[model samples]
Target chain A: MEQSFLAYLRGRTRNLPSVAVGIGDDAAVLNFPGTPEFPSTPESPATPDSADTPCLQQVACTDQIIDGVDFRSDSQPLASIGYKSIAINLSDIAAMGATPTAALVTLTLPSLNATEIAGEVYEGILEACAEFNVAVAGGDLSTYDGPLAISVTLLGTVTAPWLRTGAKEGDAIFVSGSLGGSLSGRHLRPIPRIELANRLRQHVNVNAAIDVSDGFSLDLDRMLASSRVGAELNIEQIPISDAAHAMSKDSNRSPLEHAWSDGEDFELIFTVDESDAAALEELSADDLSVNVTRVGSVVGRTGLWKRITGSKLERVFPQGYVHGETDE
Target chain B: MEQSFLAYLRGRTRNLPSVAVGIGDDAAVLNFPGTPEFPSTPESPATPDSADTPCLQQVACTDQIIDGVDFRSDSQPLASIGYKSIAINLSDIAAMGATPTAALVTLTLPSLNATEIAGEVYEGILEACAEFNVAVAGGDLSTYDGPLAISVTLLGTVTAPWLRTGAKEGDAIFVSGSLGGSLSGRHLRPIPRIELANRLRQHVNVNAAIDVSDGFSLDLDRMLASSRVGAELNIEQIPISDAAHAMSKDSNRSPLEHAWSDGEDFELIFTVDESDAAALEELSADDLSVNVTRVGSVVGRTGLWKRITGSKLERVFPQGYVHGETDE
Candidate 1:
């Protein structure tokens, strides 16, 4: 079963030139066009004549989707499970402002109907890879007696990569798309802001960036903690999704609360200088494909806050997704 | 629980300078000292002035261990489960003839007693990382209702990598350490053969390599199929462990069968040019630490054969571990 699945993947990815050694090896070997911009050191310069000097900076990350927790194996389509697993990881690559190159997938399947389910899962994975222009370099497959789980490790290349710790105090906060209420299939069908991030970086300076996986407020808290800054968000200005409004109809929770709390949105939350913010807004207006919204501004204080009514700032508690915390 | 586990890992890996951004971000950033040997093509070379050219060929692989399938979480110690998960990935890196560098672990735990089990698992991961000089760069943690599953993605560096398709018809097949009877504690405590592979590569040209995860015959069959070669094995020359002998006592299967079929040995089986085989054997003689055994020679025929009594050649069937195949 593992062999057949690998053969399918290898047939699909054999055309990629960078994949020097793909499936059927101990590990996949790749040929990266090394960047000469970032030299190791003056004392230890990378001489082309030397046989040991590396020429490319490898960017790698891993993410996973579990059945019942992340998605329902029985209820949800396997293709979405496959797509979301890869998309979430690609979102990380986008967060780094990098161009995704390749990926290695690891799948753990249940004993019954494993092959059929794996085929559907890989179909979704290949579709996503095709959409993102990433090669399915290689992967490992196994079967267990438990529910299915999918984990993907994405590898990419970045020069002058954007980091979460690069934000400045006066930078304006921006999000790539509307947030909140991902349970309405948005979480399963996220477009990992890969191209949007690249285009934005080409036009404007992105000071810091992170993908919202653990809700807007929590992911924002991550960027703030990394940059040692705070934020003041205008609650009314946030781009709440239609799903958020619908989800909030029956509960006491406001759409704003859903926009701030519901996780797995997979949108890019970034900060830029006040001057670049206008340029980004102009770019967004010109190219309406990406919905870039300005929701807040970076503050010097050490905690997240929201402007409710008037100018009163209320401290926003860390209330987004925290794994193993069931008291939501 | 995720935060506390990440904090523990961050504290342990904070001192690694190569880790640019370790944890608490969308992804962990690493600074690989690019090798200068594989220079970029001059036509479109990575300019020193540009900020995007990568300088190193990053080697990455992901492997997984699931409860009930890979191990029984209720019976097996969590530490071994953790250690094996990392060691298997390290084995993949070693098979590439690359040095193990860093790793990102993705863990999916059950809803109950997740924290305590996670701590033990991470302790084992950290211990293995310390032993291998690998940094725990970052990881994702989640909880599910099913059994625990651990997936590790290991990143490494290689200037000139070894591939499974590099073997020629005249190459000699060599395996490190004794084989079979891995179920007798060896499977859970198997060494990754990282250093041994490095030392052997430095001494001899390893044409092709693979780690024995799915049994000796099956993995070798993969190398044979990849290299388009065949093999002639001397059955009596194969080293069978004591546990294999003990297990064969009550069964009709021979100890040699276990040597040929039992999986999870984690030993490296490599093909080297016949000219360098003597050198590797001499190195093993001098070191006494790495047990290098020459059990076969690459043949021109497209099928595996064994030398039986009276010097007769018998075709060997490809039999070993196949996922979900229960007819042992």
Candidate 2:
């Protein structure tokens, strides 16, 4: 079974130059074209040539998906499981504003129908890689008696990579796409904002960035804590998805609460200087692919808050999906 | 729990310059100092200055451990489980003859006292990282209803990485340390032959290399298949550990059979040009840290064989632990 899987991977990853040693070795050896310094922003939005342009540095992140916890194998297609596992890692790469290059997948499968399920899962993984233009260099496969688990470690290259701790007090906070209600099938098929992030970095000075995976409030809190800053959200200005609004119909929780609490939204939350906010808005309006919403602003205070209609501010608690604590 | 763990990681990796975004971010940003070309072999055995030397490429590998399968949490220490998980990944790096740089760990835990057990597991992981000088850049943690699992993805840099397909027909095969009886307590604490691999590469031209994770016969078969070569083993020259002999007393299998079939030795099996075999042997004898044995020679025939003292050759089956099929 491992041999067949390895053969499948070898066929998939065979002619990639960056992958010096692929499926047959104990590890994959990768070679990146060297550069003297970080490349400046291109004047036009043309695809960068790997042969001519040099990669300065690499960024890396890893994410995992577990059956029943992350998704239900009985309900979701194996391809979606594979796609989501890769997408979430790519989201982290997007947060860093890096161009994803390669990924290594590790799978732990149960004894039941291992090979066929593994083949389906790998097809899904390859689909995501093909969509994102990432090479599936190598991976490890093992059997477990428990539910299926997939872990993806992705590597990318970035010139001026965005950091979560780069935000300033005078910056305006913004988010790409609407937020919340991931339970309504959005969590299983997230489109990682990789291109949008790179475009944003090229167009405006993104001071800090993060992916809203553990809910908007908690992810924003993370960015603030890392940058040693605070944020004040305008409750009316926050964009809520239709899914969140629909989910809020049967409960006391409003769409706004759903926006703040529902996690697994693989959207980009970034900060830009107050002076560049207008330019960012104009760029967002011109770009039809993504809807950028200015939800809040970085505040001088040292804690998160929400401003009500009457200019009254209330402290916002860091409530979101915490692992081992949150049910979802 | 995730926040505390991230804080703990921050404290540990704060000083590493390569780790641009250590923790509290979606991903870790790594900055590798650029070089004009691959650095030539060092004149002496002194450690290469990272700032001065140019790393040509990076190597990556991933491995996973699941409770009750890879280890029994009830019988094994949490630290040992953590140690073995990291050790196996490092062994892959060692097989590439690369220096381990960073690691990303993903863990899924059951509902039983996860935080404390995770902390102990992390302590074990950090201990191994400190010993190997590999940084725990970042990781993901989640909860599950099934058994606990840990997957580690490791990154390393090497100028000239040894590949499994580099063996020549006339190359002499050598293995570091004794083989067999890994189930007799050695599997949990098998040492990665990182330093030994580097030393072997520096002193001699290693044609091909692999770590003995799936027994000598099976792993050697993997290398032979990749290299399009075969091997003839001098059964008398094969090194068997005392534990293998002790285990053989309880079974019909001979110590030699255990040496060939028992997996998870985590030792290195490599091929070098016949000219450098004597030099490698001399170097190994001088360095008491590792034991090097001349086990076999690469052959033209496309099959594995063991030569008996009476000039009779017996075919060796490539049998060992295989994931998904093997119980252990």
Candidate 3:
């Protein structure tokens, strides 16, 4: 449903001038007619009264998660569900290399214990907002005879947004944090890579980026497909989390496949010019909130390929991984 | 659920200056750091590139509608459900006297026929956006084992926004369009009154305003409560719609009762100074897109009351009308 609907919407609204970035990416960036209030970067500190910069754009995206499918509403803490809802949307803004400002949350709740759930959920929402300094600008609450659904729309600002279509052949690809451990109860506590994205936005020439919400290989494929490019991943270089290794002990898939295909890691996959990728190594561990690993490079070849250090590159099989209801 | 949650949210986010208008209104008006893109009113007629006006505020509100509760998805046309979701949010913006700019739509789909429903819903969303000249700025899609829900967050620009807390003790109250017929199938096709709101923004000095999503008497009571005042409605002068009259034939309520107590009329209930109220009558019918009626007046008393043209006032009895899953 997500794929078919997104494709149809993209085909319908392809040439809209108001949309700087459209339906296929992490978030839609809109260029309203106005001068920027202040520079988005820290290169020059500007006050709110300052309007010396170029046009500013508004970035907006929403992600809706359900109870039975995304989480066990009956088993999980309501606060965790609320926190995940807002964090995933914040990740979408980070994927766009934008600063999150505010959010509008809509909760469609079941009729039983609605007030209790709403209050606890609001507590979680406030917790997430306080961490990001984002205002809970607006929201709606609805009750129905269904499982709880939390849909949050995060709004932000950007001047030079890193879009999915900007990556060219030969750009270096990097991903933040270890992956494939999310299903082991980490999905409810996502850490949006906002600070890393801000660092890249201020200091590097990022070509394209996406949050690994669906999976590493699948989301990387989406970004590559949108850019009309491909990538070559070094299988030996892909970082695996401890949870993945533990899950592999019981699961049919190996740790490597889990590292490549597990969803809701909330890590970031980004690309940069080779020159900037080289410069990225100079930053100490303290310079970043999360560890970033160089795993691949963009290529002109039209599909994903993987190879060990000494092996010939081979087409990466699909693995039949399902892209769930996860989105920006 | 709606009242208690709204009260809780209001108490939690009371004194944030960045939010020019907060939780207890049609929408949250945010004063972001920037000058105006263009004059929100027709009086100045400035272009977008010009920043010669005051600071611009963004009005954001979301309304989520679900099947079985807000509508019968299995019975109602899917397109009407989509249209109502967007239209209700648009009405929220109109209540703020803001011009619609863009919208973020989130669709939570039931597992079966998700793609087909999404397509039909998008058709309705596009149809509504075209009529209002609003850009479909962003959206997200998800599927779950629950009833379908459509939540739309409307973002708009406002220069001089009318709030729900500014009505003077003697202000004259007015409502747009005939009321009461909403549940007679009019609830599914709401009229946002955007043009009427724009007219009021451009010309009238609206003291306080609210959209009558609930019953007319109840919404009026809310605006008065926000204003710390009361209202005296002339029962005979209330504009009862033809649908209300038809519904009275079988319903256990009278037409007047229906006009005063039924919900989802999507009418605008507003207040103006007594002087400006007289001046409003000078405008011709073509100047406004909807019919305006002087149904009541703000009073110093503390609760809603009703009266005949020449009779004494009496307190209005609560009809046990549930507030339901509504709000900006």
Candidate 4:
């Protein structure tokens, strides 16, 4: 179904490549992905339990990426910028254990060759959408007097959503994949753990979850704070990525510090009860399609703690890419 | 149910007025308004035929408003800008003949006093959401090096969507509300005819519809072209707004020209069969809470025509605010 729609969309957007739509109308029509299609009326009702749309539990997330702030427009290609825009929102959906359904994109174009830029950007956007089977249902396109910016609102559904406020004292904290130095361009090609989270939910219960968009320690700290708990981490067990080790050579910070403080490492940080954690261990890393490591355990206290091999457990402060620091 | 949520939201956003959301969670959770409430799981699936959630058909529209282009940040209040952002999106939903369900707002803040600006802006955003009964479910807020930009994606549902391609020959075109000179500041306070369109749908079968976002003549011509027809407008019957007349005093154009050309009136221009047009005539102006006028008819010829009293039918060239004219 989506293949035909993609073909039609490809044909339609040949002239107006920013979005597959007609501005002649006031708004675009959207059918819920995996549900009955559009042109529905009062006499003809969409059916119940259409095998694909099992859970009507809708989840939504929105994020904006700017040209200069989020990425260097001069150095980075427009397509990569567009891909990152959609990817981050999908990552947010994965955090909630939701299967992404559709996206609404809005673009504010810079005062450059605006149409050419929009076409290039949306090329990557449509590519990502087709890859995920997410319909680019609707969007608003406009040229602005300033820098280019794109915001995407992704809608999805889940049988059971994992929130950031359900961690119990005995819950074991886990980090999926590795984290750190995503700013080295891996940030632009985020692999949202949509299938991994879905299959994991089928195996065991997830108490709380969050995507590490803004670094592992900071996001994990946020999850703990929301659940009204603290965590104690095993320093050696932290799955720092190779990028972190590479970054530590140039910067004074250690690889562990980069894992703790560098932002845009799109990975999953979640908590599961001890029994569910034990159940998760039985599945090989290949079974999950990603590496998962036991990082910490929820504690009763209210601050972050880390245990080192030959040193005592010590306090750690929350640090990451802090926003809202305006130059003015 | 929304009342309690509103109260909780109000209490929650006392300090953080930007969007009533937390940055801690990777994404915010959304319960479809009018559907069964949230925390829904696989075992507890949301039911079918919940009265308010009747329509399985989903519609979505997104619009982004920038500071210098759409509105003047210095003269206009941030609250009014916020209100207009959501209002324009709701206007698109209304044009689709759908009841709005939820909104996801994303803000790209400027470098100066970002937090205060976000707080003030969201004050009116929350106000508009409360008035429309649309949930402000989730949003992303970030400070950037450029001017303020707001993009709102509104989700809605309808039994049968009003399309711009359904009009037929001899159908009478009707417009709700007076038009033009919206650039005179009436553009800031857009009154989206959500209830009016709903009531109108009950009264007559609307053959086609388009919102006068750009202008009467331009949008009407676009609608007519999409329906594969032409329109002959009555020059004497053009319902000009007071703002247009006031603007005419200082400009070279007449009030009728302003009615035909100025943008952002946010009025509805629709078509119905001659029989349904007669049915609409029986409705009192008070019944719609806005003035409705028979302004034109779908013609067999393939261009816009204006027929003045005691004059021949004349061609009217399409002219309105043009976008994409960039400096670079």
Candidate 5:
């Protein structure tokens, strides 16, 4: 299988710049315009004073979506599979505040129409690349026993990459777009938020950031864990997605609970200094159609709590979505 | 399953630097160290005009190993499965003549022991990273109904990467180590020729190169195809692995036949100018225990043929395993 694919791939891939080295070598050789490490020696540069420069600081993350766990294979088309595969990686890049550059895809398919599946998947990848202006680059394909699965590794560049840390005690929390209710089909096709991220990178000095893929409570805990701090949320101010509101109306759960725990909302949950909030709000209005709302502050000790009534917030679900616990 | 795994991932991943924009944007914000379109400034030093000025280049490739196709689920151990997944990607990088820098992994699995599977797989990946000095940076994971599939994307850099198109008419064709009989188990544990690749990049201006993962005839055809030319193999000079010889002896097929058609050898096949033959041969002798032999030569013609009985070398199989071809 791999043999024939190699023959086909050698024929198909073309138009890359004159690579110093190409396929078939022990390793590939490439030629590129070199960048100075620092500003002083436009030639030699500052020699990269810090080990943490974005150039050296590698951004890597992996997310998993499963059949019956993340999607239904019987219903999801091959194009959706391909799009979703790359989309999820793009979302991770967005979460990191990085500009995606190259991507590598790995696929496992059943014996049925593997070539057609691959072609369709690549088509989906090409579409996403066009949308993001990034290259699909390269990837791996294999046959699997049971389900069709894809793993994509996307490369991105970060100039002043935002992190989950750096939030201060007085920081105000902001979220891009509404939260919750993604479980209703939107989970399958949620935008990765790449544009919103690019816009944020240009206009905001966000201290800490994370995309709300899991529930707000869980994702918030992640940010706080990185920041070595916690958040105090005003339940009344939480911007619940309309779908969450509708779901809450049918069930006994509050719209707040759905907002707190429903997964697959690819919105950005971020923290900014109090001084930057108003300007950020204005920028959000101008650049993002999505709502950027402030629902809480970074204060108190390192613990999560919600203030439904007033400043006196209460602890919500501590230890959001413990591994295997929910499955249990 | 994805949600739970992601929740765990958010916990395991540390907040690191180079985060031009950390985990919450549309796309990642990264600073690629150099200008894209122009020659390097005096300070940056444009590559010297020498024929051998090895330039920095990006080498990319991807592969997929599926259940039923790449491996039998219960047959291989989890640790081996994990190692093979990453190893396969690294092998592709090595084949590109590039030093792997990072990799992204995507996994789709049945709900069974997803994390355990991930842990084992990552353990394999981390081990390979430690061995190769590359990072297991990022990727996507999803579950499905079909089978356990692992896809990895390896990113690599090359000094003077080799190319298939660089093969000149009359350049000698050479392959590292022996070929054929990989199915005798070497296919499962094939070593990625990364070290050999690095060394070759340093010592030789390899004209054309490829790993013999596919059958020699087919893989050789691919190299010749990329060069837009034909090849004539000195069949008598082809190296046959003992395993391949043994297999042939058992099967009543000639060792020559297995050497020509067996897949998954993972050996490097390359071409270089005959003028540099002495230097390359000496270097291979000093650095690698394996033998590098001259097996064939590039020709002006555009078809692939073997050199048998004086001037007539008949056409062998065009290439090795093609994508989507049935395993049987």
Candidate 6:
């Protein structure tokens, strides 16, 4: 299916003049000449802004939530559903080291009190949009069978924003806040870290960046792949949420295991040059007010490894999520 | 719910920087800076021969599809559902006299689909994407308990694209092909007029443009509203489709009634100066190979009016297929 779809997509003829990179990439990058404010109507004349740069950079990202997979209707509130819908996309922009600017929401539902459901969903969306200062622009709504679902597309800006590549050998790796065990409350209400990312973009020269959505191990692999480098992690230094610790004992899974495989942490994992690592760590301690720990460093080897209690580093499996990869 | 949600969004924040137009507008406007087509993997940079334009222009539009209201899951294939979802958005870009470049799809579904459903859905998407040569950059997905609904956000570019207010008094209003009574097959598989838009944009200076998604009355009303002009239409001149005529008789609705408010036609309705209109019509007829007719002219009034058989003109209601609105 993926192959067929890709083949079909490759055949379309584009008519636009400023598409830059259209489809078939991790993110779509658009180039709009200068900054233009919103026109009141289609009739309003285009008033292009005179900036130093001829064109502005826009980054867009999208994610999906399913009935049984992403959330259960009975367990999740409509408001939480809406918030998380947009929150997840914002996290993607953060992964790109971009600041989220606005989002468009589309909904599918069954015949219920649409007015009431819209209110609940919008309430949650507005809450997050307000917190992030993202405008809820135009959207599409329709009815469907089965459980309720929401799809959010977030648009953001990047000024020297981090990318998956840009890492070099010997670069030090760090992460914002703690990792692992987010299935507790954090998973339900994960902070986007837009502010943190914005600050980091301003202060640090981040080599590579990715959000922890597909678990630390898998997401780290993506970051490394982009950077054309490998990485090593100290298992002892990995952070685990308090809830993960409590749940791990009963599940026979260690805290490290949860941190490495459990997804939806929404934390920023980034790399910095070795020389700037100490300075970044000190700056993080004093200014960022977040614990910046050195998990490991970029290695010449082209894969991921973890250092356990013993001296030897063991291969780590990516027990994380992959989109559209069905178990055939 | 819509009112409350709008209120919640309004209560948050002052103005932001990245967004030109925030909430409360028809569409969100943004300025993307430094948007270059970089390597997809940073390992495979694109070559210079890529035909895509490296600049960004404006992106504006709206989209919506409902179940029972838009499609029936039992009857509609997943592939068609996905195709129709994006087709509507591309139509909007065409209405603005722009070319579709990138698209963001949002889907809210009810139940879980095996790999088959995913394959079919993506299949439809890639079909549309390939046809338009537009990128499916990013989108969001979520679950709901309602009917299946899909919304798409399309980004496009305009080089001297027509505007709603560009219509001048005495400008001729022209429509592409036949309209009215799209309730049959066209509504389900309406073709987006992006190609026609591009062809006409170069030869004609369109004053104002719109796609007939709603009934001709309402959509025309919108065009008039934006141009701050009025329109006079010859009812007898409306090109009712054969499918519409068939449905009108089957449902006991007047052919004219179905043509006026049946919705989902996806045909381009545009206005041009009287002098340029003649030339455009000739050029479109000969070069574009499409029927371009003079359906009406811009008037001095603030609303829309149609000339009837007795040479009498009546005001158009501009009300179409409202989801829950009842006819008196």
Clash tally, candidates in order: 16, 0, 0, 0, 86, 39
DockQ-derived CAPRI band for the predicted complex in model 2:
incorrect
Tens-place lDDT digits, model 1, residues A1-328: 2223334434433233333333332123333333243223332354574334433334567777888777897789999899989899889888877767677777787777777777788778878887887666555677777788888888776555667778889999999789888888788889898888778866888888888888888888878887899999876788999999998998689998999888989888999899988877776434735888998999998689987779788997766876566611
User: Cα deviation in Å at residue A185, candidate 3?
Assistant: 2.2
Query: Model 5, residue A121: what's the lDDT?
Result: 62
**Residue pairs that clash (backbone atoms under 3 angstroms), model 2:** none
Best by TM-score: 3
**Candidate 3: CAPRI quality band:** acceptable
**Residue A23 in candidate 6, Cα distance off native in Å:** 7.3
How do the residues B279-300 of candidate 6 rate in per-residue lDDT, one tens digit apiece?
A: 8756745575467777889998
Best by lDDT: 3
Candidate 1, superposed: residue stretches over 4 Å from native:
A1-56, A285-288, A307-312, B1-56, B250-252, B285-289, B308-312
Instruction: Report fnat, model 3.
Output: 0.50
DockQ-sorted candidate list, best first: 3, 6, 5, 4, 1, 2
The whole-model C-alpha lDDT of candidate 6 against the native structure comes to 0.68
User: Compared with the real two-chain complex, what DockQ does model 6 have?
Assistant: 0.26
User: Model 1 — TM-score against the truth?
Assistant: 0.82
Fraction of reference contacts reproduced per prediction? 0.29, 0.33, 0.50, 0.44, 0.33, 0.37
- Cα lDDT of model 3 by residue, A148-219, tens digit: 889998888776788889889999999998989688988889999999987776568888999988788888
lDDT of 2 by residue, A1-328 (tens): 2233335434532233333334332122243333323222221112346335433456777888888878899989998899899999899888878777677788787777666667678777877887887766556677768888888998876655677878899899999889878889888889899889767866788888889888998888878887889999876787899999998998788998999878998888899998788888887434735889998899878678987658788998876876655432
- Regions of model 2 farther than 4 Å from truth: A1-55, A285-288, A308-312, A326-328, B1-55, B308-314, B326-328
- What's the lDDT for candidate 5? 0.63
Q: What DockQ does candidate 2 have relative to the true complex?
A: 0.16
Top candidate, metric DockQ: 3
lDDT of 6 by residue, A153-242 (tens): 777656444667777899998887777777767777888767777677557788888888878888888788767889887767777778
Task: Give the Cα RMSD of candidate 4.
Answer: 12.0
Q: Write the per-residue lDDT of candidate 5 for residues A24-100, one digit (tens) a residue.
A: 21112222223233123222233444434333223444444444555677787767767777787777678767666
TM-score of every model?
0.82, 0.82, 0.90, 0.82, 0.81, 0.81
Model 3's alpha-carbon lDDT is 0.81
Candidate 6 docking band? acceptable
Docking class of 5: incorrect
